[model samples]
Target: MSTNKAIFTMKLEPELRDSFMAAAAAADRPASQVVRELMRDYIERQRQADEYREYLSHKVQRARAQRDAGDFATNADVEAQAAARRETLLKQAKEAGV
Candidate 1:
């Protein structure tokens, strides 16, 4: 055990606390260790979520910049391009007897 640890407290339902303790006991591990692992995992997931949000915000900004500069395609243009590609593929598939 580390001497630098601090005690933290919070409130939760009695059933949840009992279930968690039971699970830890079943696994032959300390409940405190299980709580520490859960807290660390939760923090890591939150950090990843924050990073993804930052990336998505940057992507949206870039897209807006492109749209503002008139350097982007319209939805109709994209749909027409997709339809043309699909038609080409279908023709090629027929030619190949596929």
Candidate 2:
């Protein structure tokens, strides 16, 4: 851990703050350490969520371009393909006694 530090202050219900501090003490760790871990975890999760959103946005853009170029399958066409695949799988499953 880095020694560089700054104070962060926030207001919460006194009872909640007291309980959190007591829990930290019971676990033999400082409240600051627990708070820092929580903050870091939250930040990483937010970053991952943002990256996923960006990926989905790009996928949507690509799909839209494909649609515009008349290069994508229609919903009915996709459903028909899926139905054929399902039938083949069901037959295989029956043969395998699965």
Candidate 3:
């Protein structure tokens, strides 16, 4: 029977390694377990960052395409539309007596 465990090796500064060991001991957890958890968290955070960058890239590309196609709104036009909506909402609120 084989255990699902593998050894990972890396080099680190002596001081950092000592500190990590001490902290893990203080927390009453194995240093290897702490390192594994840290690795998992780091991997998850990196994946999320990569996904967000991809999303932002696609959004910028779409915006540029719209602008190139002359399908974008000007700042003034956007402000005017916002103002009209606000005015309509205010009229409705006044009519509702609230």
Candidate 4:
């Protein structure tokens, strides 16, 4: 991919701003490079998230079709199950230091 240079302004708490500058200095890279690297990583994560959403959408559609064909949980039951799954994931993340 072709990289284009751009300038942007940001506001940060003083402590965080100072820390970022210090880290950039220690790493021997410009603050711009650090910000750009972070942005690139964030963009990649966003792209993956969008792809995940698309996959989940398709899975949900298929599940709905199955329900129409006579296989499915009640809405309340499904929601409870999803809530439990979310909690499990959250707990796992916490345990993993995320």
Candidate 5:
């Protein structure tokens, strides 16, 4: 972890600020630690969401390119193949008593 640190200041309603401090004290954790954890979690979630959006965008572009090139599988065809694979896997698992 980096040793660098910065101070963040914000104004909050007195009631909300007191409630947050009380909750933090009840949990036996410093308010700063809880705020840091919440900030980290929020940042990580946003990062993951952005990554997933990029992944989907790429997939859509690829699918469009394939369609334009007349080299694409129909939804029904893909579903049928997936179902067949699932059946084969199930059969193998049954044979293995899995």
Candidate 6:
């Protein structure tokens, strides 16, 4: 055990407390360790969620800028280009008998 430690108190429902105690006893470890590990996992998940929110915000801003600058293709333009490519691919596939 480390000499550096902090003291804190937690209030748990009876059922939850019993479950924690049972798990600790089964593992031959302190309940505090299980609680600490659960807390650490929760904090890491929250941090990842925050990072993903920031990434999505940046992507939305970039998309808004592109739309305002008219740097986009119309649906018809995209469909026409895709159709042409599809025709070429189909021709190649037919030639290859695939």
Q: Where's the lowest-lDDT run of ten residues in candidate 1?
A: 1-10
Best by lDDT: 5
lDDT by residue (1-98, candidate 5, tens digit) is 99999999999999999999999999999999999999999999999999999999999999999999999888999999999999999999999999
Give the alpha carbon lDDT tens digit for every residue of 1-85 in model 1: 7779889998989999999899999999999998999999999999999999999999999999999999998899999999999
For 59-88, candidate 4 gives per-residue lDDT tens digits of 999998998998877899999999999999
lDDT of candidate 2 over 16-73, digit per residue (tens) = 9999999999999999999989999999999999999999999999999999999999
Better of 2 and 6 by TM-score: 6
lDDT of each: 0.96, 0.98, 0.97, 0.94, 0.98, 0.95
Q: 5 or 6: which has the higher TM-score?
A: 6
The local lDDT score (0 to 100) that residue 60 gets in candidate 6 is 99
Which 10 successive residues of model 3 have the least lDDT summed? 1-10
Model 3 whole-model lDDT (C-alpha atoms): 0.97
Clashes of each: 0, 0, 0, 0, 0, 0
C-alpha TM-score for every candidate: 0.78, 0.77, 0.79, 0.65, 0.69, 0.85
- Specify the poorest-scoring 10-residue window by lDDT in model 5: 65-74
Ranking by TM-score: 6, 3, 1, 2, 5, 4
Ranking by lDDT: 5, 2, 3, 1, 6, 4
Per-residue lDDT of model 6, residues 1-98, tens digit only: 78898987888899999987998999998988988899999999999999999999999999999999999999999999999999999999999999
Report clash pairs, candidate 2. none
Superpose all Cα atoms of candidate 6 onto the true structure and report the RMSD in Å to 1 decimal. 2.2
Any runs in candidate 5 off by more than 4 Å, and if so which? 73-98
Clashing residue pairs for model 3: none
Candidate 6 overall lDDT versus native? 0.95
TM-score of 2: 0.77
What are the per-model C-alpha RMSD values against the true structure? 2.7, 3.5, 2.6, 13.2, 5.4, 2.2
Report residue 56 deviation for candidate 3 (angstroms). 0.8
Model 4 lDDT at residue 29:
98
